[model samples]
Target: MKIASFNVNGVNGRLSVLLRWLESARPDVVCLQELKSPDERFPVREIEQAGYGAIWHGQKSWNGVAILARGKAPIETRRGLPGDPDDSHSRYLEAAVRGILVGCLYLPNGNPAPGPKFDYKLRWFGRLEAYAAELMKAEVPAALVGDFNVMPTDLDVYAPQRWRDDALFRPEVRGAYQRLLDHGWTDALRTLHPGERIYTFWKYFRNAFARDAGLRIDHFLLSPAIADRLVAAEVDREARGWEKASDHAPVWIEIADG
Candidate 1:
């Protein structure tokens, strides 16, 4: 099946553009992030009308996530990342679609490093790592796809040196990501296009998109059992160029035959 992950930034603002993309791409499943609205505020009617059903977790103005499936309602499995009772952020959502377990995450951005927020970012990564390891034990066809807010390598950014201080490309952040790989999940996009300089997000200022000044922060990690099914992966660049567009584009991957 075809599965895609996209950070729409704001559903209310990018509804029309999102609809257009849905009509064209026609992915079997989609994991969305950065909804930036309350659950009540998400446009359920518009999305349902587009022929995709979803399970979402949303907050007031930050860190919401959802999973959408074409012509079917996803089976809700999780609403938030594990490991904390008080830690509430609309950052994680998981569901089962066609027997595959999928997680859509909006990992902490934690910009302006060397502060409390960055610390939280790393702590959150640790929690995710632990949860990922636990999921690995299940031996199911699982895939975690989302805006992880991490750049795994120098090749992922237009200029690594220029982005050293950025939250996404820091050594600590990359190392944390590597730890997840060490636990046996496959980076699907990297498996398809190893060492490539493709990016999924671009800033609005400075003509970042036109100049191709961007970062690869969104990703999909498949369990070893399902890794063999990893197929095509690409970033839908045009999705970021639409009116009132989101800073992020969509990244998609096709799995083996059902």
Candidate 2:
């Protein structure tokens, strides 16, 4: 099975590019983040016409996530992250596809450090870690895929020192990310290219993409069982250059059936 993750920035604004990517890449399953639309505003029919079924949780003008699977209806396993029912951000979605469970997360972008936003980012990380523990107990084949907003190491960034003060590069944020890995999930991209500085997101400023200035925030964390089935991993860099493209390129991995 081939699975991929892409942060479209805004599904409506970049529908054409999204459609083109979907058509070209042809992944078996795709996890999308930052749809930037409310539930009612989601273009469900258009998406369906592209030969996929999706389960989405969206909020107006902000975060949202969805999973689209080819030739399969996404049976929603979870919509919002647990441990904080009051949290209203549409940042988490889980589904079962091809007998494997997958999760999509748009982790908070806690910029402007040493502030409430950063605090909330840490809090949400804690909640997600706690919630992941519960999922681990289920012992099901699974993968956690999305833009984590945390760079786990210097090797994962273009210039580790340059990003140290940024929220995504903060020590606390990195530690929280480590805690998630401690639960036994595997970072598929890292596993594939352990020593390479691979990145999935590039800032729009200063022609970041043109200069190859990017961050490896988007990820695919696999359970041990699923990790064993991994065949390869890659980032579709070509997608980033498409017209009206999102800042993020797509990351994909192939898995073998048990």
Candidate 3:
């Protein structure tokens, strides 16, 4: 089975880009983030016409997430992460697709460190850690996939010194990510291609893409039950080169049928 995660930036604005990739790649399951639209405004028809059924949680002009299952409708599991009833951001969407529990998340980009936004990012990581523990305890085949917004290690970034003070590369943020992996979730890409310089996101500034200066913030963490089935993991680097492309490209993993 092929499963992928992409931060589309804006689902409607990039509908054509997304549809084109879907047609060409034809991933069996896809997790999308950064819809930048409200639930009512999601381009459901366009997605459905492309042969995928989706469930999404959207918020206006900001964070949102969704899951798409090819030739089947994902069984909706949850719309938001547990442990934060007061938190209103639409950043998480979970579903059951083909016996796998898929958790799609758009983690907050805590830019301009030493600020409230950064604090929120840390808090959100705490919430994610808590729920991840629950999922591990459940022992179900699962994959937590999307834009994690953190460079887990210096190797995951093109230039570690440049991002030293940035929230995404902060020591604390990296520690939080490590704690998630400590819960027995395998980092699919790193596991498959250890020591390789792989990246999934590049800023529009300073011709980052042209220079191959990028960050590997998008990720796939599979529970042990499914990690053993991991066959391959990769970044669709060509998608990032397309016109009107998202700053982030698609990352996908192929797993063997048990």
Candidate 4:
């Protein structure tokens, strides 16, 4: 099955681009981030018409996430991270589709670091780490897929030195990502294309996309039970160049039936 993840930026605003990609790519499952719309306004009709059944957790004009299963409804498994009850960001969602447990997330950007937002980002990462450990223990065929918002290594960045102090490339942030991977999850894309430059996002300014100045922020981390099934992983880089396109393109993987 082909599973994909895309940070749409805004589901409503990018509806056309998203629909166009969906029709062409035809992934079996998709995880979307940054819906930037409220639940009541999630544009369910348009998505359904495109042949996807979806479940979304939305917030007004900010973070949101959704899971879409082609021609089927994903059985809801979880919503929101478990560690914080007061946290209300719509950044995490999970579901069961075709015997795979998929967890979709939008990790915090935490820009302008050395501040509260950055602190929150670290805390959230810790929570994710703890929860991910539990998932490892469950020994289930699962994948944590989404815009993690952190580049795991210098290889994943266009210019590592330029982004050293940036939250996304900062040592602390990158360490957190490595810790998560240490929990026995396979970083699918990197595992397949070990030495290649693969990037999933680009800045709109400074001619980033045109220059191929990008970052590999979106990811598909597979649990050990299904890691061996991973057959292919790639970034749909062309989608990022489309008119009125999102800064992020889609990242996807294909897994052989176990």
Candidate 5:
């Protein structure tokens, strides 16, 4: 089965691009982030017409997440991350599809660091860590996929020195991500393409995409059970070059069917 993740930026605005990709790529499962729309406004009809059943957690003009299963409906598990009742951003969604538990998330972009936003980002990471531990304990075939918004290492970024002060490349942020991996999640892309510079996102400025100046922020973290089934992983870099495309390209993994 093929599982993929993409940050659409805005589901409705990018509906055409998304539909075209879905029809062409035909992933068995897909996790989408940054819907940037309210619940009532999600283009459910359009998505259904594309031959996928989806469940989405939408927010007004900001963060949102969704999961789509081809030819079937994903059984909804959770709409938001646990442990934060006051948190309102629609950044996390979980579902069960074809016997695998999939968690899709859009981690906060804590820009202009050393402030409240950065603090929130760290706190959110902590919450995610706790919940990830629980998932590990469950020992289910699962994958945590989406735009994590952090560069895991110098190898994952271009010009790491220039991004020293950026929140996405900060030491603390990367350390937090490492701690999560330490809990037994496999970084599928890195594991498959070791020592290679594989990137899923490129900034729109300074001809970043043209120059191939990119960052590997979107990820697929699989549990040991699912990791054992991993067959291939890759980034659809060509999608990023499409007309009116999102800054992020689609990242996907194929696993042996059970």
Candidate 6:
């Protein structure tokens, strides 16, 4: 099975780019983040026409998430992250596709540290930790895939010193990410390619991509059972260089059938 994640930045604006990748890569399942469109605005026709069925949770001009399954519809499992009814960001979505439980998430960026947004990010991380622990207990074959918005280690960022004060590389967020791995979730890409300076996101400004200044914020975390099936992992870096492409490239993994 092949599963991938891409943060399209804006599903509507980047429809062409997305469709192009979907046609080229043909992943078995895809978790998309940053739709930046409301539910009613999602372009279902285009997606379906591309030979995929999708379920999305969207909000106006902001965060959104979706799961796309090739040749079939994904069975919806959950919509929003639990433990915060008042939280309205469309950042998390879960579904069952081809026997694997997939969780797609757009974790908060938490910019301008020591502020309200930063606080919210930490709070959201806490909720995720709690829920992820429960998911681990369930012992299902699962993978949590998305743009986590945090660089878990110095190896994940191009210039670690430059990002230390930034919300994405701050120690607090990195520690939270470590706690998830410590709870038995496998960081698929890192596990497979340790010591490699792989990255999935690059800033448009300052010729980041050209300079190879990037960050590995997007991830695929596999449960124990699914981890055992992991065979390959890669980042479609060329997609990030496409015309009007998203800052993030598609990240994917291939697993052997059990």
Q: Model 2 over residues 1-258: C-alpha lDDT tens digits? A: 999999999999998988898999999999999999999989888888999988899989999999999977788999888888789899999999998999999999998998999998999999888887877888889999999998999987888889889999999999998987899888999998999999999989998999999999999999876789999999999999888999999999999988
- Tell me how many residue pairs clash in candidate 5: 0
Q: Which whole-number lDDT from 0 to 100 does residue 122 have in model 2?
A: 96
The superposed Cα distance between candidate 6 and the true structure at residue 233, in angstroms, equals 0.5
Residues 1-258, candidate 5, lDDT per residue (tens digit)? 999999998999988889989998999999999999999999989989889999999999999999999998899998899999999999899999999999999999998897899999999999999999999998999899999999999999999999999989999899999998999999999999999999999998999999999999999999999898999999998899999899999999999987
* Ten contiguous residues with the weakest lDDT in model 6: 161-170
Please give, for residues 1-258, the per-residue lDDT of candidate 4 as tens digits.
Answer: 999999999999999999999999999999999999999999999999999999999999999999999999899999999999999999999999999999999999998897999999999999999999999999999999999999999899999989988989889999999987888999999999999999999999999999999999999999999999999999999999999899999999999998
- lDDT: worst 10-residue window of model 4: 176-185
What does candidate 6's lDDT look like per residue over 142-248, in tens digits?
89999999999999999999988999999999999999999999999999989999999999999999999999999999999789899999999999999999999
- Scored against the true structure, residue 189 in model 3 reaches a CA lDDT of 98
- lDDT of each structure? 0.90, 0.92, 0.94, 0.96, 0.94, 0.96
TM-score of each: 0.98, 0.98, 0.99, 0.99, 0.99, 0.99
- List residue ranges in candidate 6 displaced over 4 A: none
Candidate 1 runs further than 4 Å off: none
Q: What's the residue-level lDDT of 23 in candidate 4?
A: 99
* Cα lDDT of model 1 by residue, 70-144, tens digit: 998999998888998788898989999998999888899988797889998998998899999889997888999
Q: Order the candidates by lDDT, highest first — what do you get?
A: 6, 4, 3, 5, 2, 1
RMSD of each: 0.9, 0.9, 0.7, 0.6, 0.6, 0.5
Q: What tens-digit string does per-residue lDDT give for candidate 3 at 132-242?
A: 999999899999999999999989999999999999999989999999998798999999999999999999999999999999999999999999999999999999889
Model 5 weakest 10-residue run by lDDT = 111-120
C-alpha lDDT of candidate 4 relative to the true structure: 0.96
Residue runs of model 5 more than 4 Å from their true location after superposition: none
- The alpha-carbon deviation from the true structure for residue 106 of candidate 5, after best TM-score superposition, in angstroms, is 0.4
In angstroms, the error of model 2 at 182 is: 1.7
